[model samples]
Target chain A: MTTDTTTQGTALADEIREGAGAVVLDQVAKSFRGPTGVKMVVRDLSLSIRPGEFFSLLGPSGCGKTTTLRMIAGLEKVDSGRIFLGGVDATDLPAHARNVNTVFQNYALFPHLSVFDNVAYGLHRQHVPKAELRHRVMEALALVHMDGFAMHRPQQLSGGQQQRIALARSIVTRPSVLLLDEPLAALDLKLRESMQEELKRLQRELQLTFVFVTHDQAEAFAMSDRVAVMEGGNLVQVGSPEELYLRPATRFVTTFVGRANFIPASLVEGFSASSPDEVASRQLSESPDGEESVGAEPSIFVRPERLRLEIGDSSGQIKGPRVRGTVADKTFSGGQTIVRVKINDDVELSVTCDSASNEARDASIGGAAAVTWQPSDATLLDR
Target chain B: MLGRGLRGFVALSYVWFALWFIAPSAIMLIYAFGHTAGLTQKGLVNLNHLGLGNFWQALKYPSGPVLVASLENAVVATALCGVIAYPVAYFIARKLGPRTRAIVLLLVVLPFWTDYLLRMLGWRIFLSPLGLLYNGMQAVGWHVNYLSILDTRGAVMIGLVYNYLPLFILPLAVVLERIDPLLLQAADDLGAKPWTIFRTITFPISMAGVVAGTVLVFVPMLGDYVTPTLMGGARGLMIGSLVASEFTEGQNWSLGAAMAILLVVILVGIVAACWLLATGVRYVLARARERALARVLVTT
Candidate 1:
């Protein structure tokens, strides 16, 4: 596909610019005076979120995901950065002043007020009329499918219900950007899955920008249009869920976002002396008009689902650029079997295969199994 | 169990302990209902019928001065003490961090640990002409009579409130500590302004502590007489003083016993009412939760 120069230019210009529902964070940093010493929690980070886009910050704990979100919400002061909300400079604005709401990890719903009152809180502060406030609150709750629970207090609701109420409270104000800090982390697995669907649907219906923060890669990938993976206070990469999963730009991205089997591979051919970090080059080498550079001695990233496991006499050996391994462990998961095999010397790789086959069920552990994938399936990521 | 020797010994000990505490009150109640001559007979002999005469006499006391005034004054003083203590307790429990909480709590309790009479005397002098307050106020260009507050209802109320404030605050602080901080955060996140948050969430949740603190402060304030006599003079005398006067100065034990019985009944009623209200609130919250669950179940 041809790169749209205008869109790229617009996205670039948006880094320092802000418009309605657009948030720009320019070189933001936050440090805390800890017991040990001054610790840098978030270091010089710059990113722009387009209006009405569901952007996710995916990372482990202490990776500055919450800190960055807090800065945008004006809950935490940025040490140095310019934050703009809806084309207005809001770096110094207090939490109440900024037109942003947050669904905290604990779903900090007011325990005293009913769901209706809680959702009506911000509107009341803005001196919205009673009828309009009621209508807006009801509308927001309806978006989350919680309209029937208007009079219920937060403590009276279940975890999933409380989460929806939290969402309703934030969306009731029609904020330019709704910030969610691991809002579904406290729910049970079943409830969390259901809530994730509800949240996605609510976002679509509301048409508001949502900047979510979570450490769960599956949750981020399943919901977000674009995921910004952060590690150790630095944003490693930002792209669509498919792009991040397929073409991870960094070693951290490959390991953090999904389960990947990294194998040490030698570049037999197609590596140029210049631009040694490009993996796209090798995949497009046969295409005479391709614009990519291959690198030497690259680590090949193979996802679990991409690997095709076969039982044959040619076991413990790779075929067609596929490495061989012995099945050390096999797990029968519902719908899929995860087989762990010794890929290379001192390295173990996990491969997931279809559970519908009786062949996998009959395959015993400690036996040799051949695993192979197409060249396109194996991404040569330069670390 | 009393058939065995060891059991008999334990039973005797328990009976003796119970009698030791209940003996005085039992005797007082018997005499208050009995005629004037019943005290002389002794040994639980010649019990008389119960009559409302003692209560009437107590109410329409010597010189027909309404005895209810002192009781009312005491009740008001106790309520005022609770009002003053709540904010201080809230600050210690919620606002102050660990170290500051300890220091502030100690300061609140320090006054009660000191000599009670001496504290009252200190207040007396403080309200007098040569005290720091009097001198300071005079310097501030206010025309003031330092002795005016002393031997007045205001002075007595102040003394009672000052003495019992910590008793109310300590219990309140303990209950406040149990409340989750997230409850408050939830209120704020729901769009409540600071005042609304405090009124709806903080104030209602802390109601149990308020009742406990009020009973602790008010019950004692009602029975106080020394502070009234020393600081409030004739007008400041509370129900405790009336009870004391009937026995010692007035030589009317029957009337004093009647007044004591009435006070006990009132305190019991107050306690029962508080318990009922608290339980009712809990039941309402639980019912609301059940209804919500039922709705969810039906929808699912």
Candidate 2:
């Protein structure tokens, strides 16, 4: 692709478009030699990020999310298999040779260089003309709204400003793919939230694929077009935010993506097929006759928000399966009240209710209530 | 109000400084400006007579050449020490693990356990005509001319480098160790190759160590007398040895004091030069900071 180097914005956009590619990992594995022995950090990890997509690798720390991102950035070598960038094998390429950039978790700004110089570093490496380098650097700084602080050293800037400069530095090169290893992990919550929006905007405007690694599921979900959930060096699930939240494939995903209540399958009767009222009424009739058949297999995973609490014996009218429980604990958390319900001696479920609702106000510790949820609201997963 | 014990301690230290340092310096200053008595007075006994005659005689052709040679030797030795110490420091700081780094640093400083006089004596034996080094070279089938090797300028350079190498390495290692490895990784991620990273990031940051190590090695080398006296036979007439000879063999105490004063002035000039260079760097950085602040203000 021929790019005009005269106009700065067009040049940058053209460079990104030409370099941007879908990153494909084919059966990649990485291991590190720890003090004890060899420990596997990532095992047979494989995923494809499409061009211009904001893909997130989400997991707890030590789950190999960062390692996987590093391998793609060529910061870490794959023990086996290959990585492809723009449909070319880049498995053996050094970090500098790869058309990839990373915004480090610590921001890692060169304390010796000014903000302008730091941002212009990548272009300088490319040996671009000085005037063009300045133009592109200024363009990047302006994009991050840091044009005024060009001459300031990285140490002089705040944490959030340093993060912005880091982003500008990485993106100024217009690499094929940008890897962000928990770039917002160091910022405060408010700044992180705003930077999340800014990152999303930049990804869209640049049209470059972004592979973001973060343990913060909310941040990942808020920013990603597709989220890959990892656990113990393996990819558990990859899907849209809503799909993963509503129809999680595993117990790990159910708990990791959001708060979930896992109930034994034996306690939930006809959880997959019947409504709460039907199951509750059938259970009530069976209880009078002293005959209750709790099914086996398929544990139920229900989000706290999906489970509702109603005072007194209101099981007959509830639309989903209902279970009788006493409110073990009730916490008023400003906007929502979290009520912990004990259904049996060993079974406890959390139900979230809006604080403004009468049900939340009525939920007092030691008071009797029925927890109900539609069969469709709960995901049935084999342990 | 100071405590009684603290006051006493302070007073004692001041008295010690006056007795040891100030008294000697004041006497030397007075002697440096005094005239050397002739055969009748015998050995600069005319202390009551003071003038600029001794300084003028010391700054003449012969003494001036000796001073210049001494300075040249010091400068070359210090430069060589800096060049040789940096890689050793980098290896210890960046490449080795903590235990190994500690061991290596210990080995580098092991020479300090021996007395300075003993170490120079050891070098003198090693570089002698029938020394172990000559026999070892002969065993290796290399015909090294032993006669030309010992008590030469080369020997003096070697002795100076050997003595001050640890001093140069320690500070450089400390500075290099404190650099965050993350910065290099960040530079790599920014498309900087290894050489470029070293040029742009590593070298510039380690400059403080370079300056500090230079001063550490150079300052002592300027006034070093024993190394040249032992290793530099005929060509080793440095200012320090010259002063020593004047005080002892020549018995020209006034001339020795004058030469000592000149050496002190030159050393002070060097220190002032280093200070100016450091302040110049700080001034540039401060100006850059001010410019940045100005730009920030204009934009706001």
Candidate 3:
């Protein structure tokens, strides 16, 4: 919370003077000198990562997520902002002086050092006691399941093994925040899946704050306690994966997070006018903590899975907004079946039902179809 | 796995090598195994008495001390060149743009355009008492009354380093340029200072270049004929001049050829010893790591 009055502002600031968060970015900005002109990579971004929290910065390529991670690790300097690591201002610190470490995208392990020496690099820099350094390095290696590779050179290891060593090397120092910059992007699907679970377990066991950078939404949503969605050098939304998926704050978030079925402005106005109080109450109940305004305007939005499809008179008994149309197409995808309903020439809606459900079995191409969704599942895309 | 055309080219090169290099070296080898007989054929060899006598004779008396002095010059010159070349190579490879790097490399090899003997003669003139360097220092008002390093081993060392420095820089720079910049960043991220990164990562990775450059300069210095003759005078005599004197004035072609063979054996022996030492050190390091890991494994 913030106050405009000087006295209250000072009081509020003093109370949390120790640290507001484990890692805090106060309006960070970065720009690169492009061939054409100065190109803004990240602009006016403010965020706070909680202690022991597994946080992720999720975005497409060139969306400033990796740049944000680099700035946090002090590998890249901020154009105009402040970064705090464990309550200390780390904005002016060089990379080596910062208490944070990163697992690079390519896992840039030292080619000359053995696995043990690479993992022990940070501890050696700190002049940690020789015995303690060895114990900790072995401990870190064991955490990554690479204990047997202590004497092997990085060149002799496989990609997966090298990835484990890079992870071990970064975490050996027990930094304030362990930053991972697309650390699993190069792995194959099977290795990436297992590494995802391994990373989740490591975070939980270590109880260390993790700032993971990734472009894959599924990967970020599956592992992070909180996720920040970035687009065009700005923070679009920051929330739990469930919140971002269910209560997307912007049009970009609505489309980027999941597949969406839209009820046009023409249809939305009719239902919104007839049931104004109902829409307001549904919005309030879904976000009871006063995030209703975050969805600024009532825009009829529904996720494909939430759109219930029925074959006949059973649709009339449904307890929500309903529409009748002809089934345009249908597809069976093992676990679920998707049916396309043509409401009019200009409007069509996709509805998903359980593959073995009676509704899916009953729906036929060119036949009459009914679509309805629960009021609570309705979302208003912010204008 | 060479292509058809490349295989042809390789075969052609081998033929050229055999004709130009192998034939001459083989003749010298035969001379090294034979003894000289009769005053009329003193400069020529007598093939009847084939033995290691010439090799032993090459190592005896005045020749032995000259061989040692030659080795000393090679060692000193190679070390100085390596030390001077590393930083220049590192700066060009790691810090400069490709365009700037090419320019600097051109400057490094600029002196090689001149003739080798002309360069040695140039140095001899430059280090003379009334040379350009002495006058330049005097013009700068240095508090010196005398300047004479012309006929000394120091002047010969300078010539050796100046002549071979480009050889060392080119190879070291090539290897340094090939190192991934990401490794340096990784080191910095892992809390290593700049110097620590260079010591632990950069330097060790460029060792191939260091060894190659050492052989490039040291091997040539062992048989150098011009620099010591021009600058080493009498006291700084080297094995190369001794061998030259034997062939020209002493008319002992057998002893001269044998000296060349002895140099070859010593060079090969030194290379083998170094290779063995490197292997032994690597083995020791691996064993020490195992023991350290075992101790930690027990404790934890």
Best by TM-score: 2
Q: After superposition, how far is residue A324 of candidate 1 from its true place, in Å?
A: 3.3
Q: B1-300 in candidate 1: lDDT tens per residue? A: 346988989988989977886887787777667444455665432346677677666666541353466556667777887787778888889889889999998888888678988998999889876686788788898766554788888888788778887888898898888787766654554455678767877888787788777777767776677878888888777777878887788666767777777666667887799789988997898677557544543442
Off by over 4 Å in 2: A1-11, A267-297, A313-316, B1-54, B61-63, B144-146, B245-258, B274-300
Whole-model lDDT, model 1: 0.75
Residue-level error in angstroms, candidate 1, position B45: 10
Candidate 2 lDDT over residue span A50-127, tens digit each: 998999999999999999988988888899989999999999999999999999999989888889889988999999
Stretches of candidate 1 above 4 Å error? A1-19, A265-298, A315-319, A357-362, A381-383, B1-32, B35-39, B43-46, B62-67, B75-83, B90-95, B128-148, B171-211, B247-251, B267-300
Q: Judged by lDDT against the true structure, how good is candidate 2?
A: 0.85
lDDT of all predictions: 0.75, 0.85, 0.83
**Model 1 CA lDDT for position B232:** 86
Ranking by TM-score: 2, 3, 1
* lDDT, model 2, position B253: 86
lDDT of 1 at A316: 35
In the range B65-124, model 3's lDDT, one tens digit per residue, is 779888998999999999999999999998999999999999999988888888888887
Scanning candidate 2 chain A in windows of ten residues, the lowest lDDT window is: A283-292
Q: Using alpha carbons, what is the TM-score of model 1?
A: 0.80
Candidate with top lDDT is: 2
